[model samples]
Target: MAAGAPRIFVSHLSGVAVFDPAGDQVGRVRDLVVMLRMGQRPPRLLGLVVELATRRRIFLPMTRVTAIQSGQVITTGVLNVRRFEQRPTERLVFGELLDRRVTLTETGEEVTVLDLSVHQLPARREWEIDRVFVRKGRKGSAFRRAKGEALTVEWTAVTGFSLEEQGQGAESLLATFEQLRPADLANVLHHLSPKRRAEVAAALDDDRLADVLEELPEDDQIEILGKLKQERAADVLEAMDPDDAADLLGELPTDEQERLLSLMQPGDAADMRRLMSYEDRTAGGLMTTEPIVLRPDATVADALARVRNPDLSPALAAQVYVCRPPDETPTGKYLGTVHFQRLLREPPPTLVSSIVDSDLQPLDPDADLPAIAGFFATYDMVAAPVVDEAGSLLGAVTVDDVLDHMLPEDWRETEFHLDEEEVATDGS
Candidate 1:
């Protein structure tokens, strides 16, 4: 749902059909995953549990959900088919919340929860439980309860569902720090006790855990990856950026690396193998295999739409590569690039090929860190493409990855301390 969308009552979403961007049916909504906060602060809507055609259930993060309209859930078409596993801090709206008994703040009368309404906050993507539909009647099952005074009340008007202050565990901790950036969260993990860090890591969803793992120190990344079950570890690895996954896998013993690589999708495994074959400090090792790739005939509008994908990092989204046939990396012919700024200036219908900047020479896959750094400095580029001798567009290296290799080993290991005042101010 977008900003200013209507509040959707949970009762309507149950068993709703879910479709992909292409309008192909992917699954049906089974349940919603929410993170309940301390007090009656309104639980954040995490995502939904979608049951696929294969009778397998998957966790579809709200970030991937593009629309919830006409009793159908439309996704961005980028889905992780892994089974949904409820986290320690997560609550199932249908299974656990409905039919529950609670008191109204205004009348002090007990009411049974018939349903809950959720809405995306205006100007933000975060969705939260907003209101409660309850009945002021007896304590029987909500469906069978004799209809009495039924009304919708503000989420704060009800009590009993929110987490309490005392004896809080990982769930509460996750809810409290929910708004932290991946880097900030990784820093938090770095400072936590091993047990606590493992608990927190386990509680995070695959996509989220993959992101946090990317930002963490190498040792911390390995430790967290090691703690997860082998199957889940493979899933997390597949979810990660190809270069980062390769880097992590390269750190393991040959046997361990092969085991994880074997479990990953063939294409992903191939990318990892290709990356691992390169010297760690070279362009091939540093570049991400999955930059936005489009054909010469693609329009500026098409490029812009690709850039808008939430999954792409800012660096990766800065520009798009226009190639010949075979749009994927190792594409047909390495055509020039079209910077995002160029796309914005051109009319929507303008072909990307016309605005392609061929002036900047591409990087060789074997280009060393210093050489790649020189190219970035000379061209003032945030990212640059790498092409093979066959003129195939291999991948692109972003400045952040360049810095990761160039900077001192301890650069990301800063001791992040939140003073009492800072903690109170931001509720850290």
Candidate 2:
């Protein structure tokens, strides 16, 4: 569903039927899984607990739900199919929240939660419980068939529901800073106590933790990874960019590295191994194994679609590489680069090979950092392909990765400021 979707009351969603893409019935929504935040912030709606025909319940993440309209839920048809097990950080709307009694912050009067209204945040995929439908009456059954004066109020208007205690762990802190960008969040983590830092790290989801870990200093990355369960640590590593993952893995003991590698997917582990084989300051080590690679016959439309993926960094999306065959990395003979600007200037049906720029030379895998930096500067390129001696395209290195390595080790810690007189002179 798009952002700004209409508010959906939990009571109205009771036993709502859920269907797959082709109109096949999958299950019915039994409960909504949410994680409560500190004090006044609304709780984040995680997903739905759906009950299958076979009496099995599975958790369907909100990301998978394509739409919730006309009293039915539509899914993208992809599911884990595993049984639903609520984590310590999760709460069920139907099972736990419906019948709860809370106090109205405005009047110190008791209220019973009748239902909750969830709405999607504008421009974001997140859904949150923004309003509480409560009744000002003595606590009775979860749904008391409309007893006293009922009204909808902001989520913050109620006080008994949020985390009553804040100092015990990072739950409150995490909730407070949930909306921060990765770089800002990294700064926050850097200033936290070691124990609290680990707590926050452990609380974050795998994907989020991966992004934040990439921004943190090497020492913090090592410390956080060291404290996690080995299996979880492996999963986090797999979620990280291949180049960054390899860099972090290179800092561990040989035995430790081998152990984690064994737990990762064979394909992912192989990529990490290949990257680690190169010198830390070489093109091969600095390049990410994942890139937009297509055969010569692929159309501009296909390349555009690949570049539109939200997960790709801007530098990686700035260009596409056309190869002979075997589209994945270690792709067939490297062909030519197609800038996104060129794609926009051509028709959608035009073949990428016809417009490819073969005049630009690719970087050798063994190119040193200084050589690679000079290549980018000389060409005014944001990204460049790394080809092996055999003419196979291994990966592409982005400008961001080059800057990360080129900057001084202590640059992240250094603070820069100017006096008022200097600022006035330079005009900021």
The sequence of per-residue lDDT tens digits that candidate 2 reaches over residues 129-210 is 9999998878765465647899999998989878855365567677767778887777777767777788788888667789
Predicted candidate 1 versus true structure: per-residue lDDT over 376-419, tens digit per residue: 99989999999999999999999999998888888876445444
**All models: lDDT?**
0.87, 0.87
Worst 10 residues of 2 by lDDT: 419-428
The C-alpha stretches of model 1 lying farther than 4 A from their native spots are 20-24, 76-80, 121-126, 142-144, 414-428
Worst ten-residue run, lDDT, model 1?
Answer: 419-428
Q: What TM-score does prediction 1 earn? A: 0.90
lDDT of 2 at 101: 90
After superposition on all C-alphas, the RMSD of every candidate to the true structure, in Å, is 3.3, 6.3
